[model samples]
Target: MQAMQQQRQSAAPGALAAFARFVLCGGGVGVASSFAVAGLSSWMPWALANALITVVSTLLATELHARFTFGAGGRATWRQHGQSAGSAAAAYGVTCVAMFALQRFVEAPGAVVEQVVYLSASALAGVARFAVLRLVVFARNRSEGAATARPVCVPEGHVLTPAGAAGFCRAA
Candidate 1:
């Protein structure tokens, strides 16, 4: 029971770390996408502007997310980037479609109503994006060779246990 408790305690930090990374990356992407849509919509059709902004922002976000969020430091390949972009695009498309349908029927009398609709749609889309990103784009698979690779260590203290020796081996 003590061992199990210790194990759970050890795992808690990892889970928190991952969640922190996700929040940071998600916030960055959200800001980028929001700014892009608002800025571009002034010069172009709202739909086109939204799509363009989403794609560009998604690509940039994916790179940051893969490196910072998923601990996939050295594995940010074009394929992985593409996969993230695809997931973001799908999420964006769904949001746009829903927003359009709602706006068409919901007859907003004032600017506030329109704003609420757009904001709500964007929030829903963000939820979808995170789900796809966590589950599909950056799926955690123990069998994946990358996950099994030993982490590099920074010099700290004298090696004592077998685990310490393995860490030293990795560092060396």
Candidate 2:
């Protein structure tokens, strides 16, 4: 029981550390992608530029999140990549909506204004993406952990196992 409590406590601190790494990896890719989109927009439609950059950046960021940010213990699996892409799609929608609002409300919004709006929207979506990736995409397998638990002999002819686990005891 005490070990279980300590394990829970240690997990809490890992979340904070993961968030910091998420920011560093994801944020770094996002910033670079934002600039890339801004530059590409000069040659093509802004939406096209955004779509291209989003795809590329999502791939890069997903890899980073799986390996470093979320500590998934290896390269991202296909399922994880698919889930991350789903979240990225939502984030793309958010940025698009933000840019559309900026255009609708402000006439001839300058490059700086566009960049600011895009970055702000991206940041908001990034927070949500972090949660989804941490909780759903790369989360540790609870059932596997439970399966490895050692059974404890608590009393005469009685054995106990960790929560969500099964144990066997001798019939007395």
| Cα RMSD, each candidate | 8.2, 6.1
* Candidate 2 weakest lDDT stretch, 10 residues: 163-172
Candidate 2 per-residue C-alpha lDDT over 1-172 given as tens digits, one digit per residue, 9 for 90 to 100: 6965755643322788999999999999999999999999999999999999999998899888876787665577889889999999999999999999999999999999988999999999999999998888877533445566565446665545555233443334
Candidate lDDT scores, in order, read: 0.66, 0.83
TM-score of each predicted structure versus truth: 0.66, 0.77
lDDT of model 2, residue 74: 57
In model 2, where do residues sit more than 4 Å from their true spots?
Answer: 1-13, 141-172
On residues 1-172, what C-alpha lDDT tens digit does candidate 1 reach at each position? 5954643443312446766776677766776666667678789987898888777777777777676666554446677778777777777777678667867888764455645666566667766776676677666531364455566554776655755554465334
